[model samples]
Each structure stands twice: as structure tokens, then as C-alpha cells.
Target: MPEVLIEAVQPGSPDTGAVAHYGDPVREQRTLEGAAGLVDRSHRGIIAIPGEDRLSWLHSLTTQHLTDLRPGEGSELLVLSPHGHVEHHAVLTDDGTTTWLDTEPGTAPALLDFLNRMRFLMRVEPADVTADWALLSLVGPEARIPGIELDPPKVAPVPGAKFASADVAPRPTTVYSTAPLPGGGWARRMAYGYDLLVPRSRVAAVADELAVPWAGIWAFEALRVAARRPRYRLETDHRTIPAEVGWTADAVHLDKGCYRGQETIARVHNLGRPPRRLVLLHLDGVSTDELPAPGTAVSTADGRDVGFVGTAVRHHELGMIALAIVKRNVGDDEQLRVGVSAAAIDIP
Candidate 1:
């Protein structure tokens, strides 16, 4: 991993944590936007759920319409605490025999435990298989990678970009769920591209052979921030509600049956606003001199603290932008400051 993303570091650029780019951040980002690029998403967790009642049992435990989910279908499910806070989110793809749950890297343990605890009289079996399975993603203009093919399920779009496209048709990338692996595999049209779940032993071979630019953690962070996608710990916490972070529309089903936190979800959607709202902050200028990091305190004019930056990135197009969860009353046109910076950020 270090050999590709770090040891071959680019001078003058920060090369850390499987880094943002193999060498060039902007080039990598452009190829990712205009053409295609392959990324190592092995850091994400994979949980295998198998049992006779796998779909139904899981359908009743989380937010989503999974009871009737088909073998090759895909959807995002949120595990909310009984109080309605987002506890976990799993990108799902079922393969007839088992349901594959792609979780946040460090969250599989607790999610697995929660699933186990809720299995009192059910026949469901959940296993944290991240160690056995490796994940990889391909993003950009191209779709339908070779050796794998599955009709794209009508899933959520890429939330459409903020400073880009208006229509959300055709999807960000095509699906690739079918594979000819002897060891079995999985894939989905998720994230901003197609994600493949293959045997761990095969990850390196596939990664090395991809004919596309490589994007490390940093590049992906920028795109994710541009996409305005929020994760468990970064834009979420113990008290964070799905509605607050915009997960309500993508992951929650309003007409669905009961689940752990349905009451709170209903109460908020029907009668009240989430205590907070997710916003995209286009920082004042092109000065990357003092880029704000996550957890950087946010405030109003003249020093009134308002919110904290959830995720910040030097976007390929948007320069510096951030995803923030601010109080619901924070107006969309409200002028805000990041940390003590004099430049007021815009909620674009």
C-alpha cells in the first residue's frame, strides 16, 4: 500500500494515509472527473449476513425497504439508535445466499455486536468479513468494467454535484454485480462509482492492473466532500440524526414499516425540523494557506460560535469547500466564519 500511495510520494504534496493522490492531486481529480480512475477502498468494512430470514430480519432492524430486496439490488440502510440518532449506515448488496453490508472502516465491530444482540429468536447470522474480503472502486465517466456486469439498479444518484450537473439521470456510474470468480464476489453501483468486493488475496493483483489513475484517501475525501456525503464519525455522532445530515431522503423510507427509531423519524419529518441541517460551505478565497480541518470551530459575524466544520477539502473544481452540520435556524444565505478567519464562507 505504501509503495503505491506513499513511498512514491510527490514532492511538495502531503502524502499520508494511503494519501489523496499517487502523485498529482489535481490530475488525479481531473481524470476521475473527466475520464476514469481506480481507487483502493479496502479500508471500508464488509459484513456478511447469512440466514434463512436474512433480508426480513435485517429489514425490520434498520431504515430502508429491504424485506423485498432482490438478489442483485442495492440500497443504503441506516442503523439508528432507539432515540433516532444514526448509529450506523451499511451500503447493501445481496447475493441470494447472503447480504453484503459495506460499513465504515472502524464501525464493523459495534454494528456486528448490535446485530447479534438483536438476534434473539431470529435465524440471522452476521459476520465481520472485512479481513477476508477486499474492496475496490472505479469511478469517473466509464461504466461496466470488464469481467463484471450487472444491470444498474435504479438506486440513488450521486446527489448531483453542487457546482455541476442539474439532472440526476443515468447514475454516476454503471453497476457491475456479476463476476466470474471461483472464490465468489460482490459488486454494486455505489459511492461515486462501482465497488467490487473480492477475495483479499486478489486485491493487489486487480489494483496493480487497473488502467487508470490512482486516488488515495485525500483525493477521495475531496470528491466525497464535493458530493456532500457524510460518514458516521465525521459528520455524525451519538446525537446525530439522519435528517440532520440529509440521510433521511437517501437512506430512510417514509412509507416503510416500523423499525427501531421510526417514531422519532416520523415525529421529526412530519412535525418538526432536524435540530441541525447539512450545508456546503464554499470558503472565501483560493488561499489554501490556512485550510480548515475537521472539528475546526465555526462561528457567525464578529465571533459568535455557530457550528464546526465536519469535512473540508481542496476540491478539484470548488477549491476549498466544507460540509457542515449547523443549527436548523442557520439561514442558507447566512454569512459565517471558519475559526477566526476574517473571510466569510458561503453556503453554496
Candidate 2:
């Protein structure tokens, strides 16, 4: 799905090259909170891995346990560098014959290259199908769209996927689903939603069928910050480990078999500490209406830099809040500063 296509479906003023909201961002946020809004995430990337050995092969490479992954079940996984830094993050669902991997934008090319090189004569093959498949999401509360029925447990694994064969790929009829994002840790926290993998050719039509107000990335980002969800690019740097952002809860299987970065994970876990910890900072709205920008310096009141802000946004109800990584020793009552505003830590 191209930016132009996204613009075409969007109902309001363009925030950038893409339309960020439909007239009022706060209204869209409210719509999403009621689970009556559609969010276009078509810019994200999607990959298709098809072969008899897809599950076991993915099990050996990623942090998630895919070996026993039941068909239609969704799991979040991470690819770590040799030194244990996060390299890629994906939420995937395997339908027996093929595993669909959904990842951040601009991630598919590199991920596809990495997978191709790692094949090593295995029966598994992976391809970038982002141009053919797009993603749409419905968030908040029970998060149900009118026409889509998502029942992962009842669907059995099968070999007749529409895109099973790489050479003769066809648009998939089945819409794969992911588990709801884990949500909590703040007031006015809305339940996170699930993702749907739909054909790119029909993305506009599918979104139209929902009959709900549309939300842009702005509303989604605000909600994500309030929910304490960590985005790979925003929350992670070159040296970030999964433990730093509490990603172990959803993305890492501590007891899983060896992968590229297992040693670092084990060392960090056994030592009982990571160098940094993720925290939520409530910026003082009275001092400044503006929130700290991503990568803005977050420091102790005395001016010692502790860490950088990952994401900062004004929630529809939570006021101004931001997610930052700070030294683990930063006390619960410590007052931090982001730019000109004083910040209070919201415990995760």
C-alpha cells in the first residue's frame, strides 16, 4: 500500500504525506477507545514464509517458540544481534503451511535478505509480500470489526495457502490474526488491538467495509505511549537488549533453545538487572504544552543526562506523557527533566 493509496482512503486533512487524522485527532482517539475506529497500518511490512519446515526453521532462528505453534496462533518474536541487541521485531501467525510475519516499515527488505541467506538448503523459503499484502487494525475494548471473525484456536493448520508457492503467488483470501497487544500501566489505558493481514489490492475496500471512523498514526502513537507498548525503532538503540524495555514479557521465551543472542539474555537475566529500564514520564503540562521529542535528553533535576525519550505524546485523557529509558537506579520519587518541563515517573 502506497502513501497515495492511504491518502485516498483517509477522510480528513493530511498531517504529512499521509493523513494523520480525520479533522480532529482527539475525536479519533475517542472513537478508537470505543472500539469503533479503523486504523490504517498498511505502511507496515509483511513477509510470507512457506514450506514444510517453516515452523521448526523459524523456531531455531527467532526468540519465540514456534516449534509447537498451533495454526492461527499468533506470537511476537525478536531477532537479536550476536551481542544480544534487538535487530528485528515481528508478530507472526502460522497457518500450518505458511507463517505470516508482520514487521515495522522498511524492515522487510533487510529481513528478507537475512532469511534468504540463512536458508542453507532448508525446505523453507521466505519472500517480501508487503506490496501484495497490507495490514489494518481495529483497536480498543473488545476490538471487533463487523465483517471479520477472528477465532485462532478453531482453525486447523492446512497446506492450501493462497500464497504458499513463491513463484506463483496469489492474493490470500484468509485474513491472519495476531494476539491482542498487552495493555496497562497508565490511567485511561485502553485495551490494545489485533492486526489483520489483508490483500493490498482490496485494502481500501476492506477498510471501507468496517463502517467506523478512521484514525491516523498520531492517535495510535498516543495510545501506544499510554499503554506502555515499546516500538522497536523508537524504544531501542544499537545497544538495546530486550530486557531493557520489559520486552521479555511478550517477545522472549527465556527457556527456549539457543539462538544468536541467547548468551547475553541469559547473562542479563541471571545477573538480575539490565543497565537501563523503561519508564513512563508524565511531563508537567503546566510548564509547557509541548512534549519532549524522540531522542530528546532526559536528565536528573541536577542536569546529569540519564537517558533519551523514546516516544512522547499528549493522550486524549492522560494529558502529556512519554516513555523513556533511564538508569535503573533512578528512584521512584526522583524528579526528572525533559527539555524545560519537570517530569514524574509513572511506574511500569
Candidate 3:
């Protein structure tokens, strides 16, 4: 696992005595598709935004159209700088009283400060709840997964997922917000999972409640890459425009009232192409044990630096795979290389 993935799942034994992959990545992926697989994603920063104005206030600032989000609805939102660079990508869920934000690690403090500064007497109160709330993810068949369905992420190409809708009573010890994820068929890339926003005190108990074999970051990273989902740190940064990464649909509501960086998104999406495009690299026969590092240069056959690789993984099914950003002008069939190994680019 790369450092980013290692840190995400490294809480290892301390969180719930969870084993990395239950001894087999293939079995874990199989169970994830056929039975159940649990992943501890609690390393993500958790922030609680509470108040009457929370939804409306957040709506005005982010790229998502959140003003009308009812309780139990989840949306992905991005906060952009004045110059329209991607500043924050948030996985947000609301339950009427409080809206929970799951962000990249070490990002909550700064994001909290930024949100607070924007709240000048509004009824919104944002609090860093990482110490109090932890995120646990459960995925598999609807019958095998413990809780009600999690919603399929909008704009996310966890594509063509048909989620189970039969309502079930919330768990006794832990309550899960509806995610409405699809069931079965990993090849569909339909995400079927639940993010248990359990109290930090109950993370262990919730892990037990799900009662599935623990999956390491390695297995989950392949799923995210195959689904074409982009993480905040690995796939984006201060220089990213949401549209450049094809996030306008899942993360941005182009018709929503103006907010920070809307202009850049609209301009690129309507009139111009994003300077770079997101690509999935199929590494040519690189050993799984020797994955390339992030920021490793990606080049054309002639060694022209078109872009750099982002998240590189040796996927269980896809072999050595990676997510990258490259110049839009790069041909679809253009063969590229990272380090000594050759790679093929599939731009999304």
C-alpha cells in the first residue's frame, strides 16, 4: 500500500483489532461482491456542522446544490478558491439536526477555521468531530450487508448501480444514514456500501455489528480506481478545477446560484476543455510488489511529460493499475510509460 492508503488503514489493530485483508485480497474482493467486506475508513477527518442555517449556508459556498437537501440525503460538495482551484472535496451527509462532513485526514482543522470565518452570525456552527465520530464502511450483497443501503454517489461513476430500497429498522447500537448503494456485480462498478458514522467510543462495537472480514486499503483502492472515483489528496489539489477532473456532474451543480469558482467551472465545461484529463493507467506487466510512487512522471512514447501519475495500485482483478492526469491532447491509443514500465492511458 502507498503511504496515503497505509495511513488510512494503519489504525490496524488499535481501532477494532481488524486484520488488514483477512489473509486474502481475492477472497476479500469476492466476499465484498458475494458476501460482506468491512473497511475502517475512520482516518478521514469528521466535522459536524449543526444549526438551522447549516444546510442553506453550506449550499451557498459549495459546488453542490445543497439548499434543498432533506434529512438523510447525502451529497458530494467541493469548496473552490476564488481562482476556482479545488480547495476541498467533502463527503457530506445530513440528518436534520447536524450535517456530518468526512474529509481528508488533517484537513478538518483548517476547513473548520475557513467555515467559521464565513459564518458571521449565521445559525451555523461547525465543529471538528473526529475525536467523537469515526467512519466505518461496510459493503457487499444487500442480504449480506448488515444495514440499510447507502445512496449511490451522484456524479460518481460507481456507474449504473441499482440499490435496494427496502427500509429496515436502524441498528440498536449504531445508526446508519441511507447511502442507497447498488448490490452485487463488481464489474458493474456500482458501489454497494455503508459509511457507519458511529461514535468514536462505539467504533469497535459497530465493527462487530457488521460482522464481516476486514478489508485492507489495498482492496478498497482498486475499487475506487475502477469506479473512477477521485480522492481529495491523491487525485486533486490546490491546482485542480473540478471540471478538469470530470467532477461537474457528481460534485458540482452547474445551474446553482453563483459561489466561489463557479465561473471557471462554467467556462471550461461550456466553452473550453479542461487543461488535463483524468486517466486510468494499465501498467504493462509491472510486478504488483513494485508499484510506482505518486508524482512519478508519466510520458508519451517519445518521453514528453504530459502529466504525472496520481494514485497507482496493483489491483487484484485489473493487475497493475493507476489513476493519472494527463494533457487532454494525448491520444487515447498513445502508449505512455512510468519509470521503466510501459502503461496505456484510458481517459475518462
lDDT winner? 2
lDDT of 3 by residue, 1-348 (tens): 312335345443222333345456666666666677777777788889889999889878888777767676676788899889998887777776888888877778989989999998899889998887667667666424434434454342212112222221111111223543222101111246666667777766665655667776567666778767777767775688986676765677666668999888777766657888888888987444467777888998898998887777766678788888888898889989888889997655
The worst-scoring run of ten residues by lDDT in candidate 3 lies at: 165-174
List clashing residue pairs in candidate 1.
Answer: 20-218, 20-219
Model 3 clash pairs are 149-180, 150-179, 150-180, 150-181, 151-179, 151-180, 155-250
Q: Please give, for residues 1-348, the per-residue lDDT of candidate 2 as tens digits.
A: 222332454333222234466677787788777666777777788899999888788778877666767665666788999999999998777765778888887888998998888899789889998888767776767566553445442222222222233322121212234332212000111136656677766666756665666787778878888888888878888989998997765676665669999899878876768999888899988878876667899999899999999988878898899999888899989989999999999965
Q: Between prediction 1 and prediction 3, which has the larger TM-score?
A: 1
**TM-score of each model, paired residue for residue:** 0.85, 0.82, 0.82
Candidate 2 Cα errors over 4 Å, as ranges? 1-18, 146-191
List the candidate numbers ranked by lDDT, top first. Answer: 2, 1, 3
How many collisions between residues are there in candidate 3?
7
lDDT of 1 by residue, 144-220 (tens): 46666656545444232121333332221222243334455766775467787889898766666556666666676
Off by over 4 Å in 3: 1-22, 142-190, 286-289
Q: What TM-score would you give candidate 3 relative to the actual structure?
A: 0.82
State the TM-score for model 1: 0.85
Best model number under TM-score: 1
- Please identify model 1 stretches exceeding 4 Å from their true place: 1-17, 147-183, 208-210, 285-288, 342-348
